[model samples]
Target: MAADLYPSSPAPSAASQTRFQKLRKRLHKDRALLLLALPGILYFLIYKYLPMFGLVIAFNDYSPFQGFFGSEWVGLGQFRKIFSDTEVLRVIWNTLFISFLQIVFAFPIPIVLALMLNAVRNQLYKRIIQTVVYLPHFLSWVVVIGICVLFLKSEGLINEILKSIGLPAIPFLTDPAYFKPLIVGQVIWKETGWGTIIFLAALAGVNPNLYEAAVMDGANRWRQTWHITLPSIRSTIIILLILRLGSVLDSGFEQIWLMLNPFNKDTGNVLDTFVYFKGIEQSDYSFATAVGLFKGVVGLILVMGANYLAKRFGEEGVY
Candidate 1:
């Protein structure tokens, strides 16, 4: 009975041998292209995938003095501490609030801008307007924050104008109420033009014949846009949205960190900033790692969920 239970492995069929040979021949034919791709593959393997091994530190009471392997294993202790801490909960809420605002308010602006640009009658004006909007994207966050401070400060231009009008100066920087709006505004101003690039490309690929057909059928401008333009770029929008959801937890670390102050900390504090304070500033490596790991898990879940919804709606999604 025991002997009967042990089965012999099947030999490779002639068809399988041919298939393997075909694959080998194809690889050899594309060797040059494969060589060109090697650097990118190696970059991800070295810089991205290789560092994932350090995630184990989240489960350990890691100490730089003891090093990675020498650190004491604490299992879920770090995660437990994260959940039990009230401050961490508040930080998580702030992170989610800011992220939600960005996704809702900032995400659609680029699409609208692209549609408007596509409808422009003159190429010269379109190019000039595109240049003006795209210029802000190249500016560093430090420069942007500096400009904001220069204009939005109590004694600055905005307040000075308000003062001239016998109006009170609004607290743009220090108030918690204004923090989320400021962050969203900065993101929109800096990225909206750059974000429109993909949508514009998608729009360009849309057949002009479709518009002509629609016009012949007595369709109006808005109807043509709704029926032809939006549907053509729907797949591109879905793919980008899925990609966006994958990084939902990453709420602009440099920008938020630069803008964050003690007075606005309640609204400005997020997982990235919290991790910086705990991991780099306070040197609580394991605890901070746990928080980062949690954020990554949540982001992964969001991406998967968004992709699933997109597919359910019969749309092409990022796979």
Candidate 2:
């Protein structure tokens, strides 16, 4: 039995080797494409992967003069300090609140807007609307914040309207209660149009025949949309949802920074803004790095878990 089993496993092993050689040859033939991808590969390596090495700073008493290698290692001291800081808890609360609001309120607006636009038969009107909506996305966060400041200020257009209607001027930007809503509104206004592009593309890919079949079954426009349109785009929705979950911690840095004031600081402070304050302003680089690194790791876990759950539900999620 041993003799028979040991006799020439060589053929199968040789076949595997031959297959490997063929793959290598095929890759060699695709050298031009590989070369084309080299710049992007190098960019990620240098900018993304290389910077990851700096995560060591999170465990150290990082000093610019001492640099990474010579810095004193403090291990979990930074994390302990972060947890003990009262403002840190507030920052975490603000970040999660803003992110949650965005996901809950702003996420679906794009999909609904896309569907509405898709239903519009008039091409000129559709294009005009699309252009108007997407324009805000291209505007710099500074410009968007400036516009918000103008519109949401006590004497702004909205307050002016309130005055005309014999109502008191509302402090939209300065009030802590209104800060979360303002952030949500800003995100919806600036990003909803841009977010629609993907949904629109997904909608375009949906087979018209499915809608026709639904119609033949005596389905109304709304019924067709429910049965055919949504079902067809379910995978796209799942994919985008997974992608969004990946960045759940990243509530806009620039926009929040620009819009934030001391009066609303309690509600407006997020992880990103906190990092700027701690790392750049206070020069506590190590502590800030630890906080940021912790957030990143948690975000990764969330995305991966979400993607896995989506796959388990038989949906196409971001792998």
Candidate 3:
């Protein structure tokens, strides 16, 4: 019995040593690629992970003079303030409404545009259209907002056209009722073409034989797209949808902040702008940090839930 027990010990150690050696060899083989990725790894470690240490400020009465370590802990005091504040609630509602609208309406635009462009037989015309549409995405938000102001202001070109056409001047940008639509429309117009690039790539990956086979079976172009093309790109669609779901809380800051006036604040103020106002403008560091932490947690939960659903449905999700 003693001899048999002693004999098993060396065998286990030898197997462990072999496994370690194999792992070492594999790492050595991929050393160059690992080196190439080191900078990005360090960047996330320093910038992203390191900042998480400051999240403790959310529970403290953080003051520049006191410093993070010297700040007095208040527990959930800041979160309580956020919950009781009606303005913050309004901001949250506005953010959710705009984000929901964008996800619902803006998300499908690129896919539709890609399908339409793919159907076009003329390569030159398709490229021209794509170039024109994609150019807007490269324009700075400031420039885009300036362009919008020129066209949508009370006395601007759109109102002028409406006046000329014997219709009343509609407030496109200034009115509270129109703010959500305007923001959604701007996002769709600016990003749709750039977004289509991925879908187009996915469409290209679709085997031509599938379409040919469908055509031979008396399937029309629309029918072929419905059956073959859409199915081929389903994975890409699900992945993008998961990403969009993750950002369902962030309605952007630059465009809304630049465009919103007192008149449009009800529908224009979002979580980002609210955080800015509370943190930088009012110097309420603790409250702002708490709100931001809340948003981040919600975003993480959304992404995780979406990814889980994607996996459950047998789709390739963001890991």
Candidate 4:
């Protein structure tokens, strides 16, 4: 009578059933963590991933009047423009040179700052310094450039002080020679402290006993830093360097744009500025998007190559 009252449902396939159960259990276990991450995941999906669909316009002779799908398909014609343009090669060269400067100069500032901060024995002073250094990062590029202009301009504070000492007021802003250096300097100032956060966090995880052992072996502070401290953070540094190479194209668009003028355009006109002039100013969206797409592809390749090299060198890269 009981058997007749109910029929058994068919069992799901063993592999699929097991996988589902495991996934469900894992989700349940990490429910709170997933919940916390939900907002960020949603944000990226909405803003970053969804908008990637618009990249299709890069393949077209896109016009506002024609709309997205209605735009004429130009194939690689837009990208062809990027390679054929003589001025673009100069802009590319400028971009590459600036990126090289940033990597060579700006990339190390954070690591150095982290080392300095890590060495500081006084917690109070370290906190104060950290707070001070981090303040600039919160300021927008406009604000930072405004502040820089206030100090670096002809009649600005620095020139005034220089003039007071019988030195000539140098054209730091106007001179093409100074433009690249100034851009790199501004990046170092703004991002050095913020970048140190990752290194500092890594440093905190290092074993304290290593320092004690180094001390027992008569290792001085410099020796300890070079031998123990730097070695311990070697992976962290390498990982960061690899990641830096990935986005080397993004050499502060807003700051450079703000600083650029007719006087410094010869040296200052980078790919970013070129894209802006073509896309926004000249309303050649397809051309601008093609240039941007090239940049993105190059960045992706750099990231992959760097990651492969990192793994070959036995350091965990940003996989």
lDDT of each: 0.89, 0.88, 0.88, 0.88
lDDT by residue for model 3 over 154-265, one digit each (tens)? Answer: 8999999999999999987766898888888889988999999999999999999988899999999889989999999999998888888888998877988887888987
lDDT of 1 by residue, 29-56 (tens): 9999979987786677667765677898
Model 2 scores what on Cα lDDT?
A: 0.88
Give per-model TM-scores. Answer: 0.83, 0.84, 0.85, 0.82
Q: How close is each model in CA RMSD to the real structure?
A: 7.3, 8.4, 8.3, 8.0
| Clashes per candidate (backbone, < 3 Å) | 0, 0, 0, 0
Give the lDDT of residue 75 in candidate 2: 89
lDDT for each residue of candidate 2 in 25-118, tens digit (9 for 90 to 100):
8879998997898778777766787679889999999999999979999989988988899999989988988888898999999999999999
Q: Could you tell me which residue pairs clash in candidate 4?
A: none
Question: Least accurate stretch of 10 residues (summed lDDT) in model 3?
Answer: 1-10
Q: Give the winner by lDDT: 1 or 3.
A: 1
lDDT of 1: 0.89
- Candidate with top TM-score is 3
lDDT of 1 at 84: 97
Superposed on all Cα atoms, model 3 deviates from the true structure by an RMSD in Å of 8.3
